[model samples]
Structures are given as structure tokens and as C-alpha cells.
Target: MSDAATPELRRLTTYPVKSLDPQDHDSVAVEHGTLAGDREYAMVAKPPDADHDPTTASVGGQGEYVNGKRTAAVHRLRSSLDREAGVLTLREEGGDETRTFSLDDPDALNDYLSDYFDEPVSVRHEPRGGYPDDREFDGPTLVSTATLREVASWFDMTLDSARRRFRANLEVGGVPAFWEDRLFADHGEAVAFRIGDVELLGCNPCRRCVVPSRDPDTGEETPGFRETFLRERERTLPEWVDSDRFEGNFRLMVNTRISESEWGQRLSVGDGVELLGTRQL
Candidate 1:
């Protein structure tokens, strides 16, 4: 593949728990829809306002799924899981103290997390479930670093990778700006994600939410991120497309799922991204 056709993976990040600190890796194993340990365990929680509308947030408990979007305080917590040992640890930033729990025990895990998050939470993991945003195992998420820098420039903010709200399993380098958006986000085009011996379908553009505006390190919200993103996208939106027909949000990434012949493959940072087809305008 030509240089433009090949994008290089720069980082592989996994979130063992949804909406917690990212676990950075030089290489990771990709399954049907997720990295091996990514979001394997998420804090099942109730709504901030369960008393008003119990049905909408009820998962047989007071509320339902809790995440950074509803509770930004989660952004303050960092998580690490020892899959082999079934141990998960949550640590606060700038503090040496840590809270450790065993996934083997459900009761204690929920109790400990409930207190720490200042909300009633039940620590839950679907042993057979791959806890990705696309529950259907549609794909893994990818965000380009070049695209990150572009967004940063729009807001006149520091180009700090840590500040990037878009959580992507694979962060890539090379390719022109917004290449992924064209191939998938804007047009929902299918492309080949090949690296080493693995193949994934660049299925769809990931939808966005308020979660990305909050800083994962401090829980502080960045203003104008959405506005800037929408403006930038408007510049690139195809004239033929109905504005409302597009699937993803103003700030979004592509979802890539493992394709046939490579159900479980190990992916490394240096993996080369080879686009198989043309990008729609």
C-alpha cells in the first residue's frame, strides 16, 4: 500500500472498566468487538434521579447503567484489572491510596464502589459479555491522532493526548486530516483494517455523547468542543447528504470490528492500517 493508504497505529488503549482511566499498552489482543480486557467490568449503577422516573433507569435496582456522562466524578477514578487473578483496583489521581476488590465476590465489590463513587453502584461484569458500546459486537473504535490535533487547533487548546475525550481502542498516525471521517464517519463506507495477520471491518462511525467533554483526569468540562466539532464537520459534510441522516455526532470516531479469519488476533502499536477501498466524498 502507498504511504497515504497505510496508517500506522501509535497507541493501543484499553479501558478495563467503562469510563475510567485508560490502560495504555504497546500491544493488545483484539476479539470480536473489544480488546481482551477492555470494559470487561463496568460499574452497573442507578440514575442520579431514580425517584422521579424509576422505570427509565431501573435495572431491577434503584437506577440503571452509570457512566462518565451521568457522573463525571468517575473521571477522577483510574482502574486496573488483573484478569488472571480477577482483581480490580481503583486509584484516585495525585493520591497514593488505592481501593482493591475481587471480581470473584460481587457483594463486597458493589459495596466498596458504592461508597467511593458517592452513589449506589453494583460492581458487575458479564463473564460472557464483551462490554463495548456496540453491544452487537459491531466493531472496535479508532481515532486518528492527526484528527485529534486538528480538533485541538480548532479550540485553541493544547494538543495534549491526555485531554482528548474521544476514547479509541486504536490511535493512529499518518493519512491526511479527517481521513477516517471520510471513509467511515461521514459516509459509512466499508474499509479493511489490516495489521500483522488480522483483519477488521471498519463498520460504522461511533456515536458521541457529553462524556467526551469532561476531562478524564480532573472531571472538568471543556467548553466549545461540540460547537467547534460541528463547525468543522459542516465544512466537510457532503452537499448531497441530508444533515440529519448521518449516524455519528459532531465529534466521533470509526468503529472497527474483527472480520472473518481473525476472530482473535494480537495487535501491536506498529500495526499498519491498510485501507482497502475508495473514500467517498
Candidate 2:
């Protein structure tokens, strides 16, 4: 049996494709500054050229990615990856039809997505580190399970909904609410932490976007989500949390970065977490 007082990795989730649903993992290898296969594929918007075929589109382009922050309709689409079979399954929220495509077949995948979003979009793959929100802090995000429960209780939402809303890659158990905040230090400094043999530098709290304010499945905007969350977050703010990192209350989870020395380290679900110390950022 696990000790409730001992901090340990409770869950590991990765989004093979950005803005899609998350996939759980029991173990994952750390590489290129992030977990392998995390955000390895992303849907990229295509340029507004009438003659340009989105099906033939390449990953390289000036267009931005189609993500939940930019497109609410993304919530209506569900996706799952079968890594061994190298296949991707997709389905609409309300539709009964399901579609499956080979991971190597970007043309077909792009075609389906283009129609779903009613715009030109293509799937882009970058095995090296993939696409992370913070360039410097591209390591997997960390959050305490207690924090998720507390946040869910705030809005009368479920733990799964809170997890989807935050989209953290790592979930730690046996810690108090907002305990992950201790992993970061004041501005210009960082906290060094370890999960089993893997060492990561805690950078700062992840600033949330509008995606968290919408329903995870329907994209319906929650009335006063931010307003109510801010109030609750501020009321429960711990003294150990660094105020320097809190530009506002719309932040949760600790963003981290991996050093080259920690590359290839494997993180597991039951790995114990230890806060080693602090380092200059």
C-alpha cells in the first residue's frame, strides 16, 4: 500500500495531438526536454490560398496551430492514438460515425480535420520535444491531485473535468492542495525537483487561457468561471507560493524544464517526488 503522506506520481498523461484528449501512461521516457509522444502531433492552420491543397500541406508554415485556445470547436472533436498500431482514431462528440487513419497518413488526417473545422488545417509532427506552450519551460507540467479536487469542488465539477481543463502532464498525489506551487521560487530563481531518477527545474506557474473556461466536451462557456475561480484561488492561496510568479490568479500547476543531464530518464506512475533545492534561473 502507498503512504498518503508520501508525495508520489499519481498519474501521467500525454496529448499525442495538441488540443485533443489526453492519453494516460504508466511509464514514459523523458527526451528532448519533454515526455516522448507528448504533443508529438499538432493540427496546423493552412494559409488562405484557394489553389493550395490542405491535403498536400507540409508541416512547415507561417500559420499557427489549431488549438482549444484559438478554436472552441476543437472540444467537439475527440481523438485517441494507438501508438503500436500507428493509428489515430477520431470522432465527433455527437456523431455516431468514427474515423481511423494511419499516423503516417497526414494527408487523410488533414483532410478530415479541415472539414471538421471548416477551414484548411493539417497535422504537423515534431518528435523532438513537440510543441510546448512555454519555450523555456517545455518540460512536463506538474500538479497535485489535491489541487484538482479542490478546484473541482469550487465549481461543482468533476475531477476529470478539472484535469482536462488544466491539461497537466504529471499529477502528484499525497500532497495538499496547491502543493506544487512550492516547486517554484521567486523570479530569476528556480526550484530543483526529482521524480525518482529524473530531475526537473520548476520554472513558474502556468498561466491559464480561455480554454479552461469552456466545457471540455461541448465548448460551452461557463458563466463566471474566471471570476469565481479567482476568488477561490486567492482565498486558498498558500503562503509558500511565490507571489512574484503570480501576475494574476488565473494560474495553476508548475511548469518545469529538464536539463540535458536528465535526458533519457524514465518517469513512472509511482515514482517518489523530492524537492532537491533551488537554482539560479
By lDDT, the best candidate is: 2
Error of 2 at 185 (Å): 0.8
Each candidate structure's TM-score, on Cα atoms with residue i matched to residue i, is 0.81, 0.92
In model 1, where do residues sit more than 4 Å from their true spots?
Answer: 1-5, 46-63, 94-96, 127-129, 161-164, 185-189, 236-249, 278-281
* Candidate 2 segments exceeding 4 Å error: 1-4, 47-61
In candidate 2, list every pair of residues with a backbone clash.
none
Clashing pairs in 1: 46-63, 46-64, 139-256, 139-257, 140-256
lDDT of 1 by residue, 175-255 (tens): 655666644423444556576667766656667788776676777888876776788877764454333325544646777
Residue 226 Cα positional deviation in candidate 2, in Å, after optimal superposition: 0.7
Pick by TM-score: which candidate is best?
A: 2
lDDT score for residue 156 of model 2: 90
lDDT (Cα, tens digit) per residue for candidate 2, span 194-261 = 99999999999999999988899999998999999999999999966655887899999989999989
**lDDT (CA) per prediction:** 0.67, 0.87
Model 1's alpha-carbon lDDT is 0.67
